[model samples]
Target: MEMTKKIAIIGAGPGGLAAGMLLSQLGYEVNIYEKNDRIGGRTALHKMGKYSFDIGPSALTMTHVLTSLFMDCKRDILDYVSLLPINPIHTLYFQEVTFPLYSDYAATKAVIKTYFPGEEEGFDRFMKENTKKMLYISPLNQFNYSSLFDFFRPTTLRAIPSLTLGRSLMDDLARYFNSKYLRLAFSLQMRYLGMSPWDIPAAYSIVPFSEFYYGTFHPIGGQNKIVEAMQQVVTENKGKFFFNSEVTDFELEGNEIKGARLASGQVIEADYYFTNLDFMYSLGNKPNNHLEKKEYSSSAFMLYLGLSIVLPLSHQSIVFPDNYREFSDNTIHKKILSKDLAIHITNPSATDNTMAPINHSSIRIMVSVPNNTSAIDWDKETKEFRQLILDTVKERLDFPDLDDYIEEEYIITPKDWEEKYHVKYGAVFGLQHLTRQHGFLHPSKKLPKYKNLFVIGAGALSGSSLPFIIENAQITTRKFLQKENPSNQ
Candidate 1:
């Protein structure tokens, strides 16, 4: 009788769940240990009264990547979850003016013409170049990162001219559009990765290309349904999941990770270990020896509100300040909240009734803030900052008597995220996606100290984003399987 290999996964995020499903399908006995009672790390949904808030990520793009994983594992994602396309993908509110960006290229072009008529030719050129860039960059995102120099190889070097790392996103947008409104609308997507357009590489504009091309979507029930579906897939594949089990430390023997010790003192061993938690957390007491510590991207302060009456806003709205640069720069050193900050509001109730009551609505207000874990006092700062955010949202959106309609409200500060998810400095995405730290420069999935240890999540290859995280899981699992069973291949 032959024994099957045993695998243990840390964290129940999308990356961990996807890797468990894949390895289980390959006849490996897999177990996932999650500190929280529920799966889906950042993708988890919180229910307050009748409102269901998507705790972290709001938009769902790159469905193909997810569906492909299901298909490869001989399962149908549609069977477990339903996804609906969101038209006009998102409504951009720039400098008090609003513009709708559609999934249809012709319609989007028409809207662009209306906003920046004189720049039509340049807009056309920009779209053509973006399409070309996406073709080259998207594949690189699906591959594993062994080293920074790998991207400079002959094959990757040929695509260097298309990467546009030489210029910033703002610099590239300025080359095409004369209207600051259009520039802000396009450049603001960089904020999704917690980067200012002036510092983010122009290649990141490929983000919009993928969204507009594939069309933005939301799961029919809520973002949480995606997690439920992944959970189902993992279970059906005979994988075990242990919730509320926190990992305290790794039990390493020689060059191999023997098992993980839970805070409760239980030990589970495996042949391979994949950690989906932030790479920094995996370092434990050895923070200095870990990847050179760099400042993480800005953490967000979110307010979820349940209203008695539905607001006339669309699914998504971005209210930018008069000076985008001021808001961007303030995040650098300031621990205090700003009145003229950028606000992103989303009404998931517009698409999913399950999120709110029949006649009511659910809204999430978000503002990026500095992770001031050291200087600012959270107890004093959270209260003052919450009031400031509420006042700013009302002033920008013209919603009167907001406190009156609020049936239920909850706020999540950076401090809350750090306490809940164990992310270092409460950084939403693992590392900041800057020019020098991106691509092969990001942490390698293969650890230097341990032979059987690997990483799969936002902190690993492909940067962040839901689709890319799942891709990292699939790619990492494939490499491990190949390494273990060369004869099978």
Candidate 2:
């Protein structure tokens, strides 16, 4: 008779939750430990009176990732979570002009012809080329790289030229879009990776293309609902979730992790451990002393507002600064906080009535900023930044008295992300996905010296996108399963 393997998972983030469900269904005794009082670390919901706001990932693209997970369990995604379509994906507002991008190819082309005239041909070529690039790159993301040379395989070798190896995301966009603002519009999707278009590799050009191809979505309740659905799946599969249970350190035997020490002075032992924490934060007295030398993604200064009155805005909108390139370089490279800022706002009340009370709005605003490595002091700058954000919103978004209807408000700074959430340096998206960081080069390496130890999350393969994180969890799970049963390998 075969004995069940005991699996210990740290952190209750999306990846952790998904891994729990997947492993539990396969007959493993899974236990997920979360530091917070609830599930969904960054994807958690914050309630302010009658308003419900998502702490992270307001929009959902690549629905098939979630669908595939549910289908694997012989269940339907819709039965677990209701996903609502977001038409005209998002409204992009520039200093001088504004336009909405549609998922419909013809409709989007029409908008391009109207706003960015003479660039329709560029849009066509971009879609055609990126579709091919996605076909090549998507499969690579699904692989579990055991070594750096795995990237040199035929599949990766064939993708070398299309990978935009030496070029930046902005460079790739410039090849298609003539207008700088249109390019900025396309490149803003890089923010999801917590990277600047000028720095992240051109292969990420697939971001905007995926948004246009697969479209975007929102859960009926909030982004948190997806995690709630996953939680239910895990629970039904006999997985146990321990809330407010924090893992302080791991007891190591040679290279294998023996047990996880919790904050309450209790140690939990398991045959296999899957740490879902940020990779940088999980390291202990390793070669890297302070982790100061490592490259991290940009952090965010977020504002969650519950307003008594709703704003006449789309479900999702972004306000780009006057000079996007300079703004990007200053914030991401020089670590300078400029007056010209790019603000991403999500008003979920417009699409889902459950987000707020009748006629009210639950708005989440995210501003990309340098991680904690910068000398910027959030304790002193938060109030000023809040004012700047509100002022900019009122002016650019055409809301003269946007502050009048605020019934409640919350602000999360980079400092808060570090102290409260334990994200290393408050880099919410974990490590930056630079060109060299792809495949086995990523810090979220699958094969660690400790054979029983594994990692899954934004800190893992690819980057911080929700779909990639889920796919990474799936791939990591597959690798682990195959190792346990050599026949599967």
Candidate 3:
């Protein structure tokens, strides 16, 4: 038998835990170092009094990705964590009407045609086209995207129609809808990537396709339970986890990584290192050079409210601005603060019993904003931004007495996320999905100067979604395992 290779993964985010769990099962000695006391980096949970909320990634789309990962480990996923389906996936509140999008193909089309009318054909065409686009591009998402040239491989070019190069997600969706409201519905997936549809690559239309195809989900306890389940898997496989251990820097011998040095002055050696941190944070003092030159994604202003009273609301709702284009341009491109803005509301307690007190609810409000790349003074501005969000939500969403019902409230500005999570430029989703930043144009997953180091997670390969993060971990683990084999070596 070959000797086991010791591995050290920085950050216990979903990516790190997934890799640690899988690789540990393969008989590697895996150790995960997490800066925070809890696991699940960004998707971790928060508790205030009797109310509980998922700090990030409240919605879980493409849950099959997780199902497959757990099953591949020879464990039934449902046994570890329970996932509840999010039907009528999201309710969209436009100026004139409220639209509910369902997961069923027939139901979604019917809703679109009923509201927009004379638009069934385009809706079908979009489903057909983006369905094909999703199938064609999905396998590529798992490819060890080392460089741009690898993206031009013959397998990808055949899926050319799905590329729709040089066009934006908004432009491509325009072909599918005459209704600005309907177009907004389909193109709104761009916001999840922290980019505007007007600038994000048309290839990203896969966001909506994935949502409709696989449907949206929420775990029983909270979305953070997904991370908790992954951590359980790691422990079952004998993987070790070190919490409250912040990695100060890498210990390198020549070009290869020897191990990582912790803030506690402990040095643990490993044969290989995986960074679950965002790409920029992983680089530390290393010259970012081309890495910094890439466009970073936008940030978010968030409010986590623990309500004394449960409101009759869906698991998720989107309130769109009367003019979405102007809103997108202001938040994404111009980086201007919009007093009147689009916001996402998530009420997890509406469905789950474990998230809050009896007859109470937990709500999260998120509004996209320019990342730290701008000159905005978040410390001073966030104080006012909180009031703007509270006022807007109460007015537009008809929660006039929200302030009185609030039992506990937690606000996170972009600066708060940056200072807390070590996110580069406070870009939660990492790189922008522009022509250069999307698809094969995504920056290299491996550091150009480091041979044994790998990057995985939102800021690295597989974009920002939770499923994609798990996929990135799987791909990175397999590649490393393959290289470990004598034949590949």
Question: Deviation in angstroms for 417 in model 2?
Answer: 0.7
TM-score of the candidate numbered 3? 0.95
Which pairs of residues collide in candidate 3? none
Candidate 1 vs 2: which has more lDDT = 2
Name the lDDT value of residue 468 in candidate 3.
86
Candidate 2 — which pairs collide?
Answer: none
Tell me, by lDDT, which candidate is best: 2
lDDT per residue as tens, model 3, 259-339: 688889998888888885453345555775777788877899889999888787888888888787787778777887887
Q: Assess candidate 1 and give its TM-score to the true structure.
A: 0.95
Tell me the tens digit of each residue's lDDT in model 2 across 291-394.
35557888999999998887988998999988777777776788878899989999888789999989888999999988898899999999999999999999
Cα deviation in Å at residue 124, candidate 1? 2.4
Q: How many residue pairs clash in each candidate?
A: 0, 0, 0
List runs of model 3 lying over 4 Å from the truth: 277-284, 438-441, 486-489
Global local distance difference test of model 2? 0.85
lDDT for model 3, please: 0.82
Model 1 alpha-carbon miss at residue 317, Å: 0.3
Model 1 CA RMSD to the hidden true structure, in angstroms: 2.0
What lDDT score is found at residue 483 in candidate 2?
A: 81
Worst 10 residues of 1 by lDDT: 440-449
TM-score for each candidate, following the candidate numbering? 0.95, 0.97, 0.95
